[model samples]
Target: MQPCDLTSTGGATIASRFYEPPGRPRAAVVIGGAMGVKQDYYAAFAQWLAAQGYLVASFDYRGMGDSRHGPLRELRADLFDWAADFDTVIAATLLRGGGAPLYLIGHSLGAQLPGLLTHRDRVAGMVSVAAGSGYWRDNAPQLKRMVLYFWHVLVPVATKLFGYFPGRRLRKVGDLPVGVVLQWRKWCLNPRYHVGAEGTPVREKFEGARFPLVALSITDDELMTERGTHVLVDCYANAPRRVERIAPADVHARRIGHFGFFREQFQTSLWQRTVLLLQGFQPSQETAA
Candidate 1:
């Protein structure tokens, strides 16, 4: 594994790691999880991809992990900023001396970012793992949705009224930027703004992209339902797309929620299944081994 720093077009620096096999490269970029989550969570998955002869790149968004923070006075979680950072990373990877066909893998929010890059002509394929198509559908319980709506409205109001969003407790204190938080609140509550490739009307620019796609979802995923996965798969009209639903028994384990699919034990099984799907093989003991 090798480490590198990449700067976005906006000049935000990002810290990243690349894992490569000894032979010819099959390069892939992985994206997923939230800004608050640790990058180490995906280490095992990246290493496994490397072992499969793919050059794997993983990075933390700016204002998270080891990457640079926002200017102290204007700190915030901005999705646009995250998207810019992703674009920069892709540019750096393609520009550097390498010749492998580029593939993209994004989980959750990471999955949507790749779809946003309409000019990604070099991407040979894409994999979206648990990518939400529409936020409104994912946040179930009409009452919870209403509460979130109220929170979005009240939080911004309170932030302006009291100099901080009320009840804005950070999972990692001082790890979040105010701008980012506000942007997220706005994006989360506005259903029209968060349309991923799954449910949205595809733009003309995306019509030309013909790369193969794989959408992976687990039956018991708390964050993304089977309906949401279907919505996502429906959006890619031009590409050869496939969906794989992991059996309940396969994904059942302590603390194995949405993010657990990338951990070690699952890497050998669930993760391998995803790779096999991408490779056009039936995922079973014979093919995976």
Candidate 2:
């Protein structure tokens, strides 16, 4: 693992790790989770990518992990910030000393970030593990929906009311900035605003229209529903998109949730499947396309 840095759109220094195989590399970028997630979270997946003969670059967003941090009250942690950070990482690392075809693999929010960049075509292909199209339709059981709704509403209100939301107690939602909270709310509440022609400017920008795309979903993802993964498939304009479902039993002991799919025991299977997909193993319908 090699340490590296890239400048964010906000002019902050972004810290990252690059894993190169023993031989010349087949380049790939691996993006992990949302705010508060560290690059170390995907370390196993990076190693797997390296083992597959690909140079993997994984980074933390500015203000997260070892990257530069600003006043929590002042930073606007929006999805746009993620998109810009991804673009910066690509420019500084993957495209810096160009090698083999570039491929992108991201999980959860990381999956969403790649779709927003302007250079999707430059990439050889894309792999989205537990990817979401922003619609949380499968978040059923009215009580659960209410809980998520309350966090979506109250967290942002709390952040604006008091410079930072009391994050230590709530962990997930509270740690984010008001802008980021609002952006997520806008995407989740309105399915039409999440992807494809009906998506927001950010979603439209990242739409995988021309690239070969792969979408993978775990059966028991607590944070994202199967429908969220379906949204990704339906929204992509790519004619050759591939969708994969990893059974819960296959990843049981690993506790492969939305975040764990790119970590631990699931890493091997995920990487192997991704390598096969990238090597032209398309679903029957997409085979002729």
Candidate 3:
């Protein structure tokens, strides 16, 4: 992997890494990172994809990780801004990889925003991992209370007094800009989440998905329940969609939560499943596990 930088449409410098194989690539994959998660978290998986003959690019959204500069309080970025960052990464990846097929691997919030991408037509397919509605009520019962507290209580207070989320100090998640946190909070409070937040434009954007889409819901994911997963997939009203629920036992483990899918530990078990999906061998619903 080599260090690189991409300039966003609005001129923000996006820090990224490129994983390239020596020969002509079979496909190109753009990894859209989860909220509050850095691009580095997906490095191992990107390298593995490159080894399989795919050119891969992983990047940080503005106001997070390497893209962040100065004070977080100064950031005016919103969700659309981050989606634009993903658009920039996609364009850069496509330019570097030539005519190879383009695939998107969206993790968590990464999975939610792809439908809004301006260059959606260029993408051949998408794999969404733990992508779900952030409605606090839809969360698993065990996590509902905490989810409510975070969205209703903490987010507002922190963003008000500090100008940004104090995620580094509170350790809830990484530090987030005020606009990103508040906008996300507003969406999660609504039953329909982002679809409700943006209304008609976003709904239409989601409806335009005609390409193959695979939604991966981890059975034991504490952050996103089965209902949450369904809420996400249902938004892509016109897509060729497949839903798969994977239990830890299927991958011979005791746990595989929201964040486990990208960990290097699953290189053999869970990651291979992603490889097959990207390669166009869609298994029967039950065969996905």
> What TM-score does each of the candidates earn?
0.78, 0.84, 0.95
- Among the numbered candidates, top TM-score falls to 3
Full ranking by TM-score: 3, 2, 1
RMSD of each: 4.9, 4.5, 3.6
Error of 2 at 140 (Å): 5.6
Candidate 1 RMSD computed on C-alpha atoms after optimal superposition onto the true structure = 4.9
lDDT of 1 by residue, 150-245 (tens): 546655565576444334252222344556656656555554334532234434334455767787776656566666666656555576777777
User: Each candidate: what lDDT?
Assistant: 0.62, 0.66, 0.87
User: Considering every candidate listed, which one attains the maximal lDDT?
Assistant: 3
In candidate 3, stretches whose alpha carbon ends up further than 4 angstroms from where it belongs are 281-289
Q: Which tens-of-lDDT digit does each residue in 120-236 have in candidate 3? A: 888888999998888888887777868778987899898899999999899887799999998898888889888887899999998897768899999999889888888888888
lDDT of 2 by residue, 62-127 (tens): 656777376767776676787778877776655643545666777767776666776665666778
Consecutive 10-residue window with the lowest summed lDDT within model 3: 280-289
